[model samples]
Target: MNHRQSGSMDSVTIAFELMRLELGAEVDNLNAYGASLFHESQYEEATKLGERGKALRGFLEKVQLLEAEWVNSFAGTAEVDYQDPAVEAATRQILSNSKSPKTALLVRYPCGEVVAEKKGADTLIEVIKRAGAERVAKLGILVNSENIVSRTPSKKYNEARVPPHFIKTHSSTAQKKRNIEQISDALGLGLTVEIIS
Candidate 1:
């Protein structure tokens, strides 16, 4: 889980720790190759375990990187700039697959003003539009608000978040809150709202 945060000791090391506890020398040699690769600056190959006894910690990132390379390998090697549009284009392709619909993206920033904000609806709409995902609104949203009790008067409040999508674009908590009234205004609208604290 430390891998979820950016500046941890790197999950690869954590994996080695776990493997050392579980399998001892049967896995000690596995870490040796990764250590050489890490020090030699040959990240991709260095981490390669030949018929290994342990699973990797941050292996998904490696798989993603390798998959990205394999998709582009025929074009000959090019410097992989993560911020490049080619990466974005590939992402769009993944997102647009009709077989799986995903939620519209959500982002949050401290409103920064001293004023209170019931502005989630507007913020969510704008974010979707900016991502060229305005069409996602028709599918509806599921707002997952949490009202944390303040220990001190006017205590810090953490806003709720939209979860990861299992499917291209559908709904999110922000979208739900935005359209709740519209859903209610209609007769026989099959909608329910739940708030968690």
Candidate 2:
């Protein structure tokens, strides 16, 4: 399921939680929880429950592919759709495996962009650029306000920063040239500019 269609973050979070709860159940019989939930036309909730099983399975497949790439790398995880049971089950299997490390390099974002199907292949480069930006922010050496999982037409999000004085650095994408130009003009006080593609 396209998670973007999940309506809102609150609903998505709730649905994912329910999906988690359902996947771990060992019995085939419907629990009192299922009866009460499914009878009320809470199909979304029901889907959530079904998805755990699917995510676990997907997770396993991801781990196998990642394992093929590195000898000792921690098993990879599948991102839960929180909408499909088979997908969720696969995700669960991948994430819950004891072999997977706690700090596994889960691909949360590739170049400040998050989508099931990426348009470009420079995500790894994007990740490195993002890391550089974070380090710069830690040092207070640069402004660090680019949205990870960037958007098209680049609508500014209400992003909150921990170090309020820190500046956000943006990557160079021709698509964002106008916004970048505007932003650079706004930072007219001789702020340091770093260009990244």
Candidate 3:
């Protein structure tokens, strides 16, 4: 796995590559459509297609730059591996139930207690607060991809008078790191994405 703290292309880099391929195809399609419309003498529709093609071309260029930037940002990242049978079990369980992928935060407090929970709104802070962490020295955060189960509850009950529920859709990993970094910085803690095989 390329989870080491070295500057190398990772999954995000690969995803950007795939995105570029798709965008390139879209741009080609738009150009072909525009040319066809022009041949049919529909000047107004042809102009619209041409403009859309231009916009897609511009966006494709931006994606390339962004991909380069993303690849360059992975210098000396401090990635730690989280090793705990219980935690691993919990993570697997959460992932099995989750409809969408989730990020888990493993928080180690000053009192030598480690808490593993899903990353969400102020989850780290809330854990610290709930743990009653005072006179803090430092905090360590481990981030890893996990599964988050989002259940859709029914307002009305079934024939058995039981409210039924099901899973639904949700939302990314690199962007997740950025968001986690903001919160970790705000809380004055060290953060690292955990390496999982």
Candidate 4:
């Protein structure tokens, strides 16, 4: 199998490939019907395609997880080809889940040198304060909009209903900016905050 970067293939393409690999002779017929239903915007039939795609993805993830467990259990002596496309894809998926926040506070010195990079508002503020407010010139807070927007179900509830406030308070862009602004005010530093989608 040819190993390609995660960015090289979209979710749909990956799903198709997985189905072809696992289902063998049945993939062509199934894909043809799925494509027809999707193009016609047939929600009922299209749902089946979506479910199948999700199942394939889940299967791939599970296989990867099992492979990882086996390798770990046998110690570091297992001869595994990390270059295989399936292994690479699975590893990428696992790593993507564990990725650090792209959002960071860039601390710069008076001489226009970036002295430190810290993730999260609280830690960044603490570090800057410790570095001494007089030595720092400008502060840049980078926010990734995708991370700020909540995709998971909110646990907090208001009057028997899940309120939007739960998500907003935890990760909304507006809330993050407000927190950063407050930090800037406290530290008496010039703030350059950018929200990237």
Candidate 5:
């Protein structure tokens, strides 16, 4: 389907379409094979085939859950339509298990910047590496203030030298700051990193 048409469809429809396109055929094939095995009285083989079918169903369920979460999170506040090419691409990436840094998902801001949801320290880094400096500079990055909270202790400070809370909060903040700086340096286009709540 064209990008525009795909976006026009509601989230549930899109999820079903993706399942039909990507998994429906495999499911049908498995069921057919399993049925044949059952007819032949090959109980073990049929059971194995059923197991495979169950695994595929589990995968589909995961996709559906992720789609629902995505829809819930972005359906209302999104700047660009959910059916935009960028959002579609990101959805495909997520479904295909190609999402870099795992936790991040792509989101487009009102100013026409496509950024990944702030995840870990490597979220922006992965985006930069995947799209490259120029492309990423154009797309931009959004960093959440909450994600900047320090979670790891600094190497320079021991538990005895500072409170654990200080290490987690202050050190994590420093690490996030360094991550942003590194991302800026890698992009080399005076890349502006938008800090959001």
Candidate 6:
């Protein structure tokens, strides 16, 4: 869908959540309220509410279909498999087994400040700039507030540190891949999604 449709969907999603929280499973109350309005001679408002109920039901069906599609997308993940000799060797070394194995993300980051390279520097340079910004935010080195890295250190701000529990929780290869991609994108880290076995 286009950006406008996507934004409108997001608004509808929020509205759906809010309505769920307030009304719970009593969604039939909307129709009841519309009936009450009709009895009170407010035909226009009742018609509007009835039309809105229909629209809400339609949106819910669309959301359910999207959810089903997303779930089905993970059914065949063999497409992510890469059968390179180097990757196989690495996988064998990591797992110590050639029969069954799992894939892990290998991230490579610059030791210190990232300096621009002369050739093919566009993407790397942009990543470097983002990495610098991320580091600054993490350290709070140039901040005007009291939550600096020196005192009241928070794990949330540490871009370089990936929580072990997060990796453990996201056990699926696809989930791990997405998580690593998000981390790599957020921190501008170089990553190799060594799709093994």
Residues 29-135 of candidate 2 have per-residue lDDT tens digits of: 22324334677889888677657535664654454344344322321232334556665455445433313111101133323443211311133233324354344
Superposition error at 175 for model 6 (Å) = 32
Per-model TM-score on C-alpha atoms: 0.19, 0.17, 0.35, 0.25, 0.32, 0.25
- TM-score, structure 6 vs. true: 0.25
10 residues in a row with least lDDT, candidate 2: 98-107
- Tell me the whole-model lDDT of each prediction, alpha carbons only: 0.33, 0.33, 0.43, 0.40, 0.45, 0.39
True-vs-predicted CA distance for residue 48, candidate 4, Å: 1.8
TM-score between model 4 and native: 0.25
Report clash pairs, candidate 5.
7-83, 150-172
In model 1, pairs of residues that clash are 100-168, 101-167, 101-168, 102-167, 102-168, 102-169, 142-173, 143-173
Candidate that would win on TM-score:
3
Better of 3 and 5 by lDDT: 5
Point out where model 5 deviates above 4 Å: 1-20, 79-197
Put down candidate 4 lDDT per residue, 78-156, tens digits, no spaces: 3332335685568446433332234433444345654333433443444435544333223332121122213243332
Write down the worst ten-residue block by lDDT for model 1: 146-155
Clashes of each: 8, 39, 0, 0, 2, 0
> Alpha-carbon error at 43 in model 1, in Å?
36
Candidate 5 lDDT, tens digit per residue, 145-173?
Answer: 12221334344222211212211121222
Considering TM-score, which of the candidate structures 2 and 6 is the better prediction for this target? 6
Ranking by lDDT: 5, 3, 4, 6, 2, 1
State the lDDT at 179 in candidate 6: 41
Show the colliding residue pairs in model 4: none
Greater lDDT among 1 and 5 belongs to 5
